[model samples]
Target: MTVAVTLLLASLVVGLATGLLFRVWALALASPLVAVVSAIALQSAGFEFFAGVSVIVGCLVVSQLAYLLATFHLHREKHSMEDEVDGLPGKHRQKNIRDQYE
Candidate 1:
């Protein structure tokens, strides 16, 4: 694979791991930094403009998607655990504030 593609994938994987394994907002910011560094490296390595841009965009998109999915999974797990702890027969717990209000 090209350097651009390799960097993009690497950045994405790191971003996903950050989002999934850590809940800290500051830690999640590393993905964008990685993307920027990869894009710069690609440009320095004589990559075409389109290739560099593609890698940058791909990195951002993948990182966002990973973050969203990870957060969603974490939230779902949290709510499920809460429900289990409630142990209310014939009753279900609401997962969010909106649900509780409604």
Candidate 2:
């Protein structure tokens, strides 16, 4: 009950941070690996097999969904900014901050 909710919330935070902070898609592998480890730990802590499995699945689903959502919004933001920049004439174009750093 309480433990499941706590785990789900933690998973959500982790997923969102991963998506927002790390652009590499390959980093999502952490979710599955963590899920398996959590399941095993729960079983060793006296949880039933089915209960532990269910909790792990829930955490994985929550985290992955959150990661997907954050990434989608990030793309949307980037694309929208690009569209604004593209409509400007070359003489009046804003210098991108990224360009300066590069």
Candidate 3:
């Protein structure tokens, strides 16, 4: 496949996997760099380097959009969970280890 097509596919897969399955913000954030590196590695000698760079840039933008969409859903889910937890009667509010005082 051409670098453009390959970059598109790779970025989409990585963005979706990291954003949906892993819900890892950092990884999702790094997907653009990953796409760029993949393009560099997989690009054909006949492919124009400037064209490959443009493809990578396009892929990066799409991946970031995908990541934002996924993270928006995650934030919604998290807020819903927190609301549910806060609705319990007689609850003192839940705290994680990070919130606990030593």
Candidate 4:
């Protein structure tokens, strides 16, 4: 029970930290953090830390890959829309509207 809760908390923290890091650094950092946390969890649980670390690293890799994939997909969609619209069409027209409150 304690192990399960710890693992859950660790995973959330790792995910959030990695996500923030991804915004600035590179996504690859998540794997190492996941591995280290997994090792600690395994040690506390009386299991082989290496194997647990490997599994956690795999999951982190998958998560980062998914994040990258989704980001690219969203970016592409945004650009496609931008290409269709070109830019704001009536900027000068809107600017010409006189303010009545002078």
Candidate 5:
């Protein structure tokens, strides 16, 4: 029981961090599901409760960090793309294409 509770709390922390990193409130709301599954899987695998919690927390942190880094990279790529488009020879042509798409 204690192990279950610990795992659940750890998962909640992970979920909260993920939600914050992604700015997605829905992820935070779904944290309990993550916790429950993690607990079950860890128990089935014969890991102690604390160890399972530690592993879950570590995974969560790493995943959230990776997501944040990816988002940053994507934002940078988008900005660079926009700049490239802006520096093209024909501004009117770009505007026309944007308008057509819109």
Candidate 6:
């Protein structure tokens, strides 16, 4: 139980970070690599074949969902910031997003 929870948490964190900080290609490459690594680790931990497969599947699914959720949040945030900039008064309005920060 503890191991399962830890695996899920670790996968979620990794997915969220990668989604936010890396490109889609990198995340695509990472999923299979993580699966392979986790499989070996689970084998050494003495998990049954089916149990290990299930855990691997759960980790991958949870991680991918987390990545999708994080990306959606970033997309929404960007749009909201753009909308805020559009609301700025004409004389004070800036063309670029960086201006919004200043």
lDDT of 2 by residue, 11-56 (tens): 8888888889886564557687759667766766778878988999
lDDT of 4 by residue, 72-101 (tens): 655663455434576642444335444433
Every candidate's lDDT: 0.70, 0.75, 0.66, 0.57, 0.59, 0.79
Point out where model 5 deviates above 4 Å.
Answer: 1-23, 29-32, 78-102
Estimate, for each residue in 21-96, the C-alpha lDDT of model 3 and write its tens digit: 7655677457747775767665754567787677777887777777767777777645555566556422233444
User: Could you report the Cα RMSD, in angstroms, for every candidate shown?
Assistant: 8.0, 5.4, 7.7, 6.9, 8.1, 5.0
lDDT of 6 at 57: 94
Weakest 10 consecutive residues of candidate 6 by summed lDDT: 89-98
Error of 5 at 94 (Å): 14
Q: After superposition, how far is residue 96 of candidate 1 from its true place, in Å?
A: 21
Measured with C-alpha atoms, the lDDT of residue 26 in candidate 2 is 46
Ranking by lDDT: 6, 2, 1, 3, 5, 4
Candidate 3 achieves a global lDDT of 0.66
- lDDT comparing candidate 4 with the true structure: 0.57
Q: Which scores greater on TM-score, model 5 or model 6? A: 6
Using TM-score as the measure, the top candidate is 6
> For model 1, how does the per-residue alpha-carbon lDDT over 62-92 read when each residue is reduced to its tens digit?
7667767777777774556545665542234
Task: Tell me, by lDDT, which candidate is best.
Answer: 6
Greater-TM-score candidate between 2 and 6: 6
Where model 6 places Cα greater than 4 Å from the true spot, the runs are: 78-102
lDDT of each residue in 1-102, candidate 5, tens digit only = 455455555655665456455555555544445656776777787888678888666545544555455556556634555457557635546687789899
What clash pairs does model 5 have?
Answer: none
Q: Write the per-residue lDDT of candidate 6 for residues 1-102, one digit (tens) a residue.
A: 566667778889889987898778877787987688778778777889899899999999988888888888888644555457666544423445457786
For model 5, where is the 10-residue window of minimal lDDT? 58-67
Per-candidate TM equals: 0.61, 0.64, 0.56, 0.44, 0.45, 0.71
Q: Write down the lDDT that model 5 would get.
A: 0.59
